[model samples]
Target chain A: MDTRPDSGHVLSADRPGRFGPYGGRYVPEALIAALDELDREYAAAKQDPAFTAELDHLLTTYTGRPTPITEAARFGAEAAGGARVLLKREDLNHTGSHKINNVLGQALLTKRIGKPRVIAETGAGQHGVATATAAALMGLECVIYMGEEDTRRQALNVARMRLLGATVVPVTTGSRTLKDAINEALRDWVTNVATTNYVFGTVAGPHPFPTLVRDLQRIIGVEARQQVLDLTGKLPDAVAACVGGGSNAIGIFHAFIDDPEVALYGFEAGGDGVATGRHAATITAGSPGVLHGARSYLLQDEMGQTIESHSISAGLDYPGVGPEHAWLKDSGRATYEPVDDADAMEAFRLLCRTEGIIPAIESSHALAGARRLGERLGPEATILVNLSGRGDKDVDTAATWFGLMDDSESEGGR
Target chain B: MTTSVAFEKARAEGRAALVGYLPAGYPSVDGSIEAIRAMVEAGVDVVEVGLPYSDPLIDGPVIQTAVDAALRAGTTTKDVLRVVEAVAATGAPAVVMSYWNPLDRYGAAAFARDLAAAGGSGVITPDLTPDADDTWIPAAREHGLDTVFLVAPSSTEERIAMTTAACRGFVYATSVMGVTGTREQVGDAAAGLVARTKATTQLPVAVGLGVSNAAQAAEIAAYADGVVVGSAFVRRLLEAPDPAAGVTAVAELAADLAGGVRTR
Candidate 1:
């Protein structure tokens, strides 16, 4: 496992699959060979033009690639000095998020490896929907493990996945949330490794996964960078995106890493606030520890028991961030900020009213962050934000939060 | 006593070792200690005191529930050390089975020192790899503690060699390509992995991950130097109506497994 120094996505030089000391294959022995095989397949795939061409074809024709970049004029005016704000419309992609980018690539890889079934763990169900979509297109059987709590919160996603012919298993073990879902998914993968592949949703997990997912999603930044340059004639002062397991943010940030002048900002979910001890701002309020197969910043007690993360958005309600983000934060390449639920909801509402775009609550964290960042940089600066997902799935939750939907009405809506 | 010493003693008996697992502070801290003592009295050769983690990814529902209960009961690393110390007092070699985070947070050097001082034999880190053992290995060795690493059916020969080279006490051979839980039958992959691992190192190879009843124990012990059971013991405790019943059930199962290994 030598470092691919010339490979655009290989960030760490000496360590092949690490971000500083954060990322490594910390899984059980059973999955090591599978991971190695995946790594080999991925490395070969990167070199094969046919693989890239087919992926590109699918991306453009099936997933609507080069998703548009829009200038948020009305949203920018609300800033302190009216800064120019731009949105990378990943929400416009098929399946309504940047998750499709990674899912499609992994689905293709699964086919290459001759695996017949794919399993994944989902939090908000966006990844599950995207995986199901890709599996359907590839004619592969799909099984998605979601926490019971998340299944209830995002019932529409469950139905959508079922309709797409993917079996959704509601995990009922340990807190019954995203972490639990991941545990179940890993168990499933270990048990069924001979015939199945685990389509990891985010830029977390073991070695090759963090790198692979980032590489697949890197198309977002590669496209956005060229599109931003063509539209603005220059790179923006700062690029911001919300961080949960940090796939979308890492996807967009990787392209801008070489540009020294462009700042990277990662906004994490702050349910109440970091100080209140109820948020998912791992980098802001947590210490480095291991969770879900990677050593990263995790919300854990002194005894290293993971703390339950709270957020209105299920996508960001995870106690750990991707290891790369942890490396970026420590290496002074990126800055992470926390946006509380109230501010994010306000940002969500503002985006809906001003830009006629309903951004997911997960994406709203970045919007909230950009607004504050704009005030600091003032009118002269430009900001690029990744609108990670569409808010159609979040309308019911939003209505309930804004008191527009009564409890009874919400129950009936579900 | 070191884990190696326990294995040597078991080898002298011309039988494989029976290793039992119980999460520290499960049911209660004192109750967990009592259960391990009972297991040892019932002829268990080694005791693995689990340090409950919030995210037990390598565990199935049974061990997850037991570990979750231990966490809910406020099990700390300190409590785990206390349990290990008590288990060790039973003259059964005790090892702490944990994910790497708690030991990392507790300070690897200090954890090794504390465990060594508590008379614990070693550690079984499910998630930590040999490549990532730069910190834990030296610290454990400095404290005269054994370092046990896992080798699976999926491991390459090179990986098996590397893992066995890093292990001091024994190589934990996962009986199946799955998390910790009971299975009706042991996976066919176990024998081959144990043979491969044995070729890499002279260290005794123990098979675990799915061994439950005496039949499975005998099946694994036929090829492995030790038979490690976790979820099955946890299942007994989980299904028990009371704490005393849990201890009785665990001891009875341990005796059965012990007899199976001896017969093998």
Candidate 2:
């Protein structure tokens, strides 16, 4: 109970349902009961030692938690004149991403809440695959809503979820991406709320979701903080993570919030580039508005309609970030920057060639930002980057982008 | 042309008021205005002009399709206000029913000022609860506009009390615990919900979300002060051969529902 990132509840939101004018229960009346029930269950479960113990058991034994931090020596040599680079290997988790942390916790809560089924929305498919894996483990009927475009881009992940016995519904509305997938999932939740629990993918949406998901995933930082101190006898100079809905970034940044000496950086997906009018750099380019139950910085036009965001990485291709991130951005606790696609891909290749690690495109953005930070802060300052997911799901996209795939190997041309 | 006047007229006629809904820019901005005009002429008492948003979480497939089409066709808040202005000019009360973002982005005070200037009544926010409302209520109070909130079958007595008290025009009691769409039968819990809402407030209570047909309207009318219909009117537009035919179809359905509200 004392392990919360809220610094003994001193830094938590002054009230529930919001983080300084960011999050609220903006959903319809139909979902109020379910959300209230979930809020009560999660609050009680979080305080119960038995619940935390069971979660810790599953995380340690099943998810292979306490995921290690590896110093990317060869990769670090290319930037900051030989600065140390530590990569948090969340890519090595059970479902190949940090998403499993939240999924497993929510799946357990689903059973405790007595819901027979669970539903989720995903982009890039990492969350969907993790949700399916947890549902399979927990014997819950899983349904995942994915953007039609994402389903095409992340075909391998689609296959992974189906193999895990989860139903995948491709959302085709409004830009056909993560935002649309969330809309479809909310619709499904509104319809089947009596028997189904919505296993929200990231640190966003209505109240409790942002806090709940962040609490579940923050163990990454909790473990890594001690590990880094043990290895180097000091905290790293900067902590970096890729932010889509900001689950992973928040996971790594929460532990460092109290450590003022450690700077926190979040790399957003910049497709084409921010100036090119094609990017998912929401916090960097967006104005404050409500979308998907949270009032956060969003890319919108003059008319308040949500503008579609572009990103090479499916997981990072969202128009919104977590409300807590919005609060952090305003409060000056964390700095966010846009990492262009070319830079991310280059970092992805660098990690592959130097460290023999294939980083997910989403995580590559953080790697790219870390390399840039190294260039600025010099070789003496250490940079810790969150390798949020593995590159297996993005192999097809990487191959196409790099022109590595033979025409014969390429099927279903994008 | 205000909501109170519309309700008063309906009470004088010894009938339940008919509140009809259509998202502006559906069909087309001009086409929706024409269709809503037809509905008013055919005896719809209140016109709830929907502000078509990009992400409508509470709307079911039919309205979603219409909203998507409207946004694709470049519907704006300006167009929505224009629709409200046109509908209010018809001597039938008009109000905006939106998902909160468009108005929030446009500035809450400015929106209330403009809506009141357009002779519109207020806002019916399905996603906005009175408890979370700070910007809109103050703005609406300044502009003398109603901020209608909803109560559901699942609403606790405490919540119903809070929601109904915050409500100005009327308390919108959703007949069912789902998004906006048609259902084969009105929810069995509707009467209980209305009665519970009535016990808490002196405000007129209107029932909505699935009362698509005359029979359902008449049934709801027996207990509720007003009957709100949406999807059935939209279904006519979708099922019609052309825009003109759609208007005619919408008029027919509105007339039927209006007759059903007579209850005598």
Candidate 3:
């Protein structure tokens, strides 16, 4: 509905919620007081320049804001087919991913709200690590919920979070994955609403979260949009990124939502292929349903039970997506497509070999999609790709996938 | 000697009633409909089918599992309505219990209207305040649906009175200090809350949280006019190897639990 600020939908202490059809405080009765407190605090915090300045200072000084917009020269020749391609270097952010943007903002907000405990759920553990990093920086008690399966697969990330002084709780129930971990985290929030703030990692879930995360991440788009405008003399033809829960994609897409001239493309993980019944292309293959706390496209059976989704990249493996993406897909302002594991991996190798930039497996999906789109566009067309996170944490997995590390070397923890 | 309709009629005979708890479809969708149906059939008085979202920081394990399953099953507001409609088709009085996002997403006024048309008798949004009820409650009332609110033991006596007046249904009296489905015994504390609430308003006060088995249900029923057993019924459905059988089995337990609480 009226999502614009002029429409009187702008957030206020009185209306600290209401994000079009996207945001509001959807919580348990027990936490109503806490939510009201947070709402009051966040509204004031939003108005406080000191809060904004402190966050801005940290984002710039600590998380390394204004990350480079590097043009993929050699990789552009191959993937871009001689077209201009630039990458917003969020990988250079502290903790090696764009997840730092939202975490830092939420941590600051948590403090302002006087909540001492921070809880989050992670899949690939990138968000967990970033949250742990923020919690350590803010000196907040952090509890991270991870799927039992993800903890084992992303052991380095697990270790990294522990190193940051965050307690990692392995969720063994349900699918034992990101969705389940989120469920567990919600349980904890419901149990400890007074002292805890749930720091969601994506631009999804019920109202305020999707909007909040996007606002926090909007820096990526704000910076990238400005960088592209300054560098290319105009906005790029398309802004493309991968969509697991649509954080980075929304991060880069939000600033350009009203910019009709700029096309936004979100690439989802297609494990083998969408046709192979092994993929996480929820926006494409899924029908309108609900999952993970919001109404959105879901990969569900006839009875509306969520079906298991698969992807080689652990981060991209989920059955549902953020509701705004569903709106964007329906409205056709943005388009979501899929890139298979083999294609993403191929792009990963090509980017590394040509540009010396090893992209995260999740980001590689966007790179792969950009490569396909760039070929169709003329050389005059410029495309901006949100390089959502770094690949350093993925080296071990990449090494195994590319057969770079020997068995013994691969066995050693990075 | 008594039925859900009779109990519901009896409650309306005096004034509105309130029932609240986290349900299975809230975090998951598979057993959500069954849970709502079972609660309704068992004479829940008014069903709060929690549409599970990601950041439910206030629910206990049973409710958490329900939310998890709702999320995993990809349950959303539309699905919640679909479930509600299915249960409403049974002519059961119900409420679409959820966080504000779904109501906002579906358009609060339209959602309330649709819920009423679908036979939803009321709403129990713990997050929505009386002052802000202008956002959706007007529309909710326009749709022939009541606005149910919550009052906890920790709530001030003034808050109890204000919320009771704001509420169209009974005041949802929390039996314990924590989220839904945490206590083994509701103890004297819940009974004391019920007495305090009764002193303030004539509205029905249904006690939930930790009231699972028949004995516990009967225990709480001794003081309060109505009793809500959520996690126990949800756990029955979830732990059941077969979902349909789980539905039937949970319905039976609800039958037993409701029977224990029913005043003949």
C-alpha lDDT score of every prediction, in listed order: 0.90, 0.90, 0.75
What's the true lDDT of residue A186 in model 1? 94
Query: Candidate 1 regions off by >4 Å?
Result: A1-10, A406-414
Model 2 interface RMSD, in angstroms?
1.3
lDDT of candidate 2 vs native? 0.90
Candidates, DockQ: 0.82, 0.73, 0.23
Error of 3 at B8 (Å): 7.5
For residues B42-63, could you state the per-residue lDDT of candidate 2 as single tens digits? Answer: 9999999999998888888888
lDDT of 2 by residue, A1-414 (tens): 224537542234565767777877677766777889999999999888888898999998999988999999999997535779999999999989999999989999999999989999999999999999999999999999999999999999999999999999999888899999999999888878889999999998988899889899889898889989998999999999999999999999998888989999999999999999999999999998888887888888888888999999999999999998998898898999999999999888888988999999999999999889988898898998899999998888888887777766653332
RMSD of each: 2.8, 2.2, 6.6
- Scored by TM against the true chain B, the candidates give 0.99, 0.98, 0.85
- The alpha-carbon RMSD over the true interface for every model, in angstroms, is 1.0, 1.3, 5.7
* Candidate 2 or 1, higher DockQ: 1
For residues B181-219, could you state the per-residue lDDT of candidate 3 as single tens digits? 636668576878888888888766777778776777767
Cα-based TM-score, every candidate: 0.97, 0.97, 0.76
**RMSD over all Cα atoms, model 2:** 2.2
